[model samples]
Target: MSTDPTRLSRLPIVQAPMAGAGGPALAAAVTGAGGLGFLAAGYRSADALAADIAELRALIGAAPFGVNVFMPHHTATPAEQERLRRYARSLARAATRYGGTVGTPAPGAERDDWDAKLALLLAHPVPVVGFTFGLPDAAAIAALKAAGTLTVATVTSPAEARLAADLGVDALCVQGAEAGGHQGTFDNPDDPAPYGLLTLLALIAPETDLPLIAAGGIMTGRQIEAVRIAGASAAQLGTAFLRCPESVASAAHKAALADPAFEHSVLTRAFSGRWARGLRNGFVARHEAEVPGVYPYVHHLVSPIRKAAAERGEPDGLALWAGQGWRLARAEPAADVITRLVDEMAAARKAHA
Candidate 1:
């Protein structure tokens, strides 16, 4: 089989694996539209992930699709844990307003069910598997390759790209700083590289022979063409699909993306302990300065409050993750979004040619 990642789909577009926003319906819709779609396995139990995979397969049949998993990393230190606890305490007043209570800091035990999910993928053998937050070890990579899975590693820097290349990954999803949700900086989640998607692609392309998939702040067909010209084989977009009808994003989240009042996206560790870009809201404004770098701990601490906010349909309290070009995202069907992107990309390329 050809190792070319682009060959997996008829279109050069790839729907990003956004944990909460993306699901089987959205994935199937994109794949059915001739683009490669991805089902995010982050924040899901092994059983839930298996169900989603089965559902996606049932819906799309043999259409090419992918799964993205969060590679586990231990980022919380003792000092960070103490700071997280203090931050949790500070949020008591806000939590009380939503009838929610912050939880105690527990970092080490959270694996996001990595082992079981990997075992499931190995046994079932998906078309493509991508990792974010960090790269899996060589043994895991070899095992997945042995199972006929095309493995992709998300990288933000040339150094990280080199490490992934050494492990022989099939491709690199070069995520830039402007990407929505979490920045996939494996070494230091607190401090991500300041480079843009095009710049990161420039830096990483010469370092490895792996196919590159550009992600972050890419919403228009022109932007996709620009990335392809810069050396990416494909473009991966998350926020552009958040408002699609097939997306599983919360109503508050979808509304926030279109609300002119939300104004701008700010990269903050307020919602999840790790750095993520989201539309600025009251919660972000109040807590961005005080939040610690203890991921999953702070993530758990803020869960109930976010849940309550979501239930109440209050955009101010929920994490409204979006890319910089969020203003360009439209409310439409997932298939329409894919078709428009593909059409636009062709037009853009033709105009340049």
Candidate 2:
């Protein structure tokens, strides 16, 4: 535990930067409770992300927290582009079923404003910055380091871990296949075979000197202790905190986490082009096979339908991203969640010792 990030206040617990679920309130609450917190910058514009950074700073002062951004994605080929168009047409039908319409798939609309967001982060440096989907250029990494920001990369394989280490990232968030939301693989393979969390940690730990933060299906204090024993400096959890009162996860999402009808989580590309873990629902069951591996385009294509589903309080149409251990999630204050985790972690460590 001596390798814990100096910026971390006390515990080695880190709240995952969950887009659409975590925000300033949740991040601040987690930080206030003696753990590192993070804000997801994936879906926000440069100005919107900046506003969040400003608000978090006002709320927590100089306390250490992190911001995560989805790296600029790869360009699609002609065949893949055609698939995107065809996929959009099918989604149009799906949208109509929900009494909604789908968004137009513009050629270059998948861009996440990566350049401006990077510029904003450089101008207003934060305690930590994490990247997923792809690696940042070496120069950008250098600039962030020079600005006194620690960098973390989310990697699903040892090859990706070595690549991030070569780029001078200070830490690696080792995401397992069980992770909620999108798998942080650099390339969206036609078929993915991801390592389980413990298996991934074992493979990546000996490959690099950089700290490892284990993520995926971690919902209990014993799980946290287990990851630490496997050589992780900390544990990052997203699904575990989804039901917290401060979390911005929708009522439907919160409810589905605890709902008996959900049964189990599955990896599906129906919501977005990228593979992600979420509760199996009618939408996923119907469209998983038809989904292309085309990222933000597919993501944008389903935006309107998802919005309509949210407005109608329908769980089936929304992406109910959750980890395997989602059944253990508790709806409580974020601080209490942290405290319970700490207490449970302590008990686990003692019992195992």
Candidate 3:
């Protein structure tokens, strides 16, 4: 492994910056194991993000790391809001139990403190900063570059990949349709352009020379190598690491992940307005087709209900995101997970030889 930014095997693995589920401890653990880790500043206050950055520095010391930022999103039109409200009412039963009604909340200036976060980065720049959900345009990218930050943006299709590459980002986190959490759709969330990891890697390869980190349904060393063989520079894994000790996943999420009934995964817009693949459950089954058109607006509305459900130990009402490869995820220390992955990669290589 060399000090090259344009290569993959240089580190062997890189931790996916999973919003809500990722934290400093998981990032530090990955970095400590000779893999690049990332801090996800998607849904946090600027002060909170700064504190997280400070804590990560203290924890990882000299290990290289990165931070992920959610692209600023605007409110949907009034028609869309009404449409989402109509959809939210379907979850009324679950909300009633928590003394709340779904879809009644309105989204008001729910920016994730972009300016303050940018200022903080300017004052204390990390090695890397990644953008998701959408591209940050040319100006934001330049500002981040001026602050000595290597920029990365997540894209699903080659069309999006080319657009991001042309935006002058340092790298592209090409997320596949099977990826967990938010879909990161730059355009409308309803118009989901599903593409598998290998196909996406291949599609983007012919269009741009930017470094690509493949994500989605990545579970084993062989799967990682398959992405590399398909033209990805590196593999970014999240679902495989969900069970890691360093991860901040809740008990309900962990329990559902292990449950055989939740083994099947589907792309649902019930949790968030954007589509994300997760362990199919009662909530998803009930509201998949009735979902609204807003992005985080609907998500913001139901978050309280979700929070209340978690507090009440109601797994059926919570959002449990997982990839198709949930069956292979193991509950172990993060160090062990990373070590075992590297070992498996080495073994696979030797076996092929």
Candidate 4:
């Protein structure tokens, strides 16, 4: 678990923390390979997150791994609340497909349990910690550093990179608009302007000396080498690993990546309220227009539906999160994926050199 950015450059492979999809086995397999693996702590309870950390620690035997946390944000407005209510009512039809009712939106109490998670991490630290959605407070950052955790912030723009750097994060996971799942944008805009990974890396590289972990639509060794040349120390891939045997991504999700009927990925807030990339489906088509820009509220509203869909092995209603490069994903072992990536990266580097 070296802190040197150069070490990251040497390995240059990081698995993105995919909530629901990524678990200890996937993280362990990725870490067991040369690259770093991260456990997603976004939707899990604090106790569940702790159990994951302990399990990962056991499997890896003190190897450096990461846990990604979602930062808290401002609650939705009155107008947004009204929209949420409407949206919840609309989901009633979908809920019946799963034999469950639509979830009630508790906007007042919608949260990820940030404090309890922070306390959990502080008391029992892991090797690495990353944050998405927003930057944690300075004190929290300082506390993590003091506890010997390497902090990384997921940023989607040069401005966001600057903010994370100013907050003293050791690295920036520059999440391009092509990224799957959530945008990691601080504000969670209604319609975010797209930023390509290479463009973001070029823009932020000149502004700060922090190591950049390039994410979004990266699924190959050539892409990894490309990011390295663009000034990123490493490449973090989530969609690429979703198909791996160790990944906990639903069978439907893994199948959807290669499914001909599921033509492409689209950024929709229908499932979670926040803009996230997933395969276009009947659910998105029906509900995308009705979703409000409220987070965990929308997330809660749709949870029951997603669970029912998963139980039924239905892809249409599940959040089949995938990046732009979904077509390039493979069904394989996690170690094999890393091996192929590293070999490909080496070839790309040599050819370019």
Candidate 5:
């Protein structure tokens, strides 16, 4: 079976899997609208992920969808760990303000439950499975293949794309620098290359035969058509779907997307300790410089603070993840968003022709 991303959906649109923002209902809505919806398995236990898969299946029936899991690769040395500890100490004042304590992460506590999630997928396979943050091993890829699952690896550069291709992934989601939320930079999480989606696609298309799904700041039909012209099989969008009614984005988050006071998005590791693009907020402005380039460690350290901020309805403290095209995001149904995108894409293609 071919793992062509274009063939998975009637429209060449994919709703990018956002950890907390995306849910089964959002995925079902996109799938029902002839685009591929995705269930994000990030930040969820295996049991929770399994339950979501079942719910999505019930909602969308046999409509093809995908599941995205964060590929686990924690390379935090003792030095990095100490740096994370120092970073935690620096946030003590802020933690006090939030009425929370930054707990010291135990050694190897940053694991994202990769093993259990993989086991769950093997037992009950989905149509498409995507791995982000890092690439899985060949055996893992083969296991998903044996279960009739189309495997996708998210890549940020031509080098990453080639590495994923060598691992025999069915497809590649070529994410760019402008992408919101956490970047999928597997090797060097600290410094990511600043390449736009079209530029990265052009750089990667010549290196691999795998079907390429372009993801980044893509939002409108014109942007989708632009990527298609640059050799992308499809475009994956996250922020555009964020305002959809089915999205699990907090009410504060939804409002922030529309709030002009928020201004622009910036790539900051203050929230997760990895380079992720999001709306610049007070937390980012205050701590981006102090953030250590450690992942799940910093993620765990700040978890309580973020949770407290969310509870207090303070957008400034929460990670307002959004791409550059967030200004164009509209509050509508996911299906309507897809329909409008398809129509806009058609118009753009026709205009270009």
Candidate 6:
């Protein structure tokens, strides 16, 4: 597959797509600066996503932008869902501490309004597209390509990268072991691919010729150039962008991101069923073991309590997602940060020379 014509060349950087962090302004800023930015649509509904797209258009002209969708899974059975409900109830004391009540999973499951969202994207096609959790079926991917959307799928291993290449994706996002949020593992959430980006690139280079985008604990420009030399076309960052002024991160989330107290993060299914890395705070420490492999179930189990905690500034109950190199992050203008990252990469290459 050929590279997408609409992709950025001025800057070989992708503003890490962040969910719930004012996506429109961040994406528009990055795109405006000649790099790509993406909005995380994981927890958003179709109507909300449509509104976000409108906001993005208002902020940035018909410039290139990307929206990432989390492929939804079938919800667990009633009993299983109920079990999650009981699990939420078990956290009552913690909820009360934040002046919140635990919530039950809504009565039914929604596909994150997949068909409608797809229809919306097809109607208002963005310049770039990516999917996580899982790739949409071939028919869906084909539809996006037909509408002129450049497709990229995130993968954790060389085997998965080869699968995306064979399936005809234009590029692959090689997310290494240290990435925050979900791991994009095609297999089990618990069974994360342990390979770091350097090792992953070495393993994948021989398998597929697809252009790669490297992601993980890529803090400094040195790490970015290392990935570039290791065979990636660009680098994507999440934790680094969490503190940007344009981000929609809550005060609590931002505070946690800057907090020296929360020194480490772990992969936990306690917040969401999928394995995600985040600051090792009160919540993960208390319940990671109790969370079941059942996703929306575990996700449902913790939704209410998380919200309650957030509403009251209780960081302990909120999901403070951050990568390993989060401490290296600095608060700055999104565009400046992007420009700096490009310069840093260049500097790293120069120093080596």
Best by lDDT: 2
Question: In candidate 5, what are the lDDT values of residues 98-145, reduced to their tens digit?
Answer: 766776666555568889999999999999999988888889999999
Candidate 1 Cα errors over 4 Å, as ranges: 75-77, 104-109
Candidate 3: tens digits of C-alpha lDDT, residues 283-342: 777777787856767677678777777777667777888877888889997888888888
Who is ahead in TM-score, 1 or 3? 1
Question: Best to worst by lDDT, what's the order?
Answer: 2, 5, 4, 1, 3, 6
lDDT of 4 by residue, 211-309 (tens): 889999999999988888899988999999999999998888899898899987899999998899999999999999988888889998898899889
lDDT of 1 by residue, 2-42 (tens): 58766799888889999888999999998988889999998
How do all models score by TM-score? 0.96, 0.97, 0.93, 0.96, 0.96, 0.93
* Backbone clashes, candidate 6: 2
Q: Which has the higher TM-score value, candidate number 1 or candidate number 6? A: 1
Clashes of each: 0, 0, 0, 0, 0, 2
Clashing residue pairs, candidate 6? 21-248, 22-248
lDDT of 2 at 58: 94
In order of TM-score, best first, we have 2, 4, 1, 5, 6, 3
Candidate-wise lDDT, in order: 0.87, 0.89, 0.79, 0.88, 0.88, 0.78
Q: Candidate 4 vs candidate 6: which has greater TM-score?
A: 4
Give the Cα error of residue 123 in candidate 4, in Å: 0.5
RMSD in angstroms between candidate 5 and the native structure over all alpha carbons: 1.6
Ten contiguous residues minimizing lDDT sum, candidate 2:
1-10
Error of 4 at 118 (Å): 0.3
In candidate 2, which residue ranges exceed 4 Å CA deviation?
A: 1-7
- Against the correct fold, how does model 1 do in TM-score? 0.96
Q: In model 6, what lDDT does residue 169 have? A: 83
